[model samples]
Target: MESKTTFIIKLVTFYCLCTLNLFNAIDIYHNDSLDDFLQDHAKKSIPKDPKAGKLYDVSLPSNFTGMEVSVVQLQSSSVWAQGANLSYFRVPPRIYPNPNVTWLDLVFSNLGNWSSYYYNMPNYTFVTPILGISAYGVRHAKGQNGQFTSTTTKLDLPLIRHPIMVRFPSVWLPRGKCVKFYSNGRTTITNMSLSHTCEVWGQGYFAIVARVPSTHHVWKLWVIGFGVGCVGFLLCGFVLFKIIRFVEKRKIQKMETESEKSEVLDTKYVGHSKMPCAFGIRTQPVLETDYFP
Candidate 1:
């Protein structure tokens, strides 16, 4: 039994060692490859449909002399009657107008899902109508009143080389949101903020995301908080289990002591003849044989 237990422990240890080694072997090269892939995608830009023209208020920043906007069709399909739409702008060059604010209007006809499979539909990408421009690039604000921040720090810019598919069940854009081309021929919407500007900063694809709610911001903090909570819960459970084990051990020890005490006390039977009485009965036979005498 002892040998069996040792072998099981060794097996488990070996398995864990193997698992750790495999996990450690996971290289960051995969992420690097993905980054390279995204860069390459930016390099080989996809062209948007010529029939579709974008109309936006262009605010030429004071510094930038050469500005060009390249519309890349990310993905599109028409299972339904609605004209298929997939578009985003990619700006590769590092020429941005300001670190404070710039605003531009983006107009398009068909705008729908991007970066998804055929079953999962996409919502409008831009949350703010007024997009903020900066030295870092273009980003949308998320709040009731759009917040402004310096964009000197860089960020991961998404680059889609070809149109990626998305799934949408509904035909019309949701209420309280702006989408679709206007019949009068203008998709007019308010910009998110003045400090935040939108311009064709570089060579890649670009589209304006209008006012996004604060709740829709990045979820990194929430994810980290949940992870910490999970770790704490596991530690609490481990401590509780140890306390239960200790209590069971104490109960077992008490029961063992009582069993030992019962074995030591060899109590006599209640209704049986004693050894002295047995001997006396054998010696004293009855002398009632008068006829025989």
Candidate 2:
């Protein structure tokens, strides 16, 4: 019984450890200072004008070794800005190694469109941007000179897309901090200002999306499965313990009953052996009767 209890305790401990490991494997990267990091690393030369319709060169930070980058747009209420489009390209554009291209062209058609999408980068093994070194945002004709515009240049303001809640392997943007661009047309990347008026359009800003670790989803599933398994294991242990205890109690009761019956039979036999003959008729005169004969 003691050994069984110890075994159950160990099993529960192991289950708890497995659950902890699973949770640990699922990492969430939420840097409150991400905005500061972007500001310090962002390029100052990228055009902030939404209607420029011109590509701006950007360089990413050395720490950003991710292959794929997402362009997230903030959502706006204006109807004209619904058809806005954003595009990205790798440096040194070429057509032959296209499979190794890290280019993306995302279009926003409605307010319900997904806020973000993952784009394929050059090679997965190496962290190189071989396609083009610039990104561009073009405001749709309907949105030009609309609610987001502040100047008389007839500029088409870039519109913000609705933010989305994604599953594991996807990063979430901080509140009011949506833009991520390159710094000084170099590899260092940064984020846009939270205030709306910082950019030329005064309505929306552009940002680079970060990739979620590949193992994130796997760990999430493992944690859930392990938690369920642990619960089941504990329940089974409790039921088995109850069953064993009930069986042992029954066996003990049967043994006590049999012992009581044996004792009663022994008492009856001893009492009968000690009792005198019934009616007390036994005598010693048998010797006289034989002499007369």
TM-score: which candidate is best? 2
Worst 10 residues of 1 by lDDT: 72-81
Task: Summarize candidate 2's per-residue lDDT along 124-193 as a digit string, tens digits.
Answer: 2112122111222323344555645321111222324332111111223432222322222223233334
lDDT of each: 0.35, 0.35
Question: Model 1: how far is 265 from its true place, Å?
Answer: 4.5
TM-score of 2: 0.22
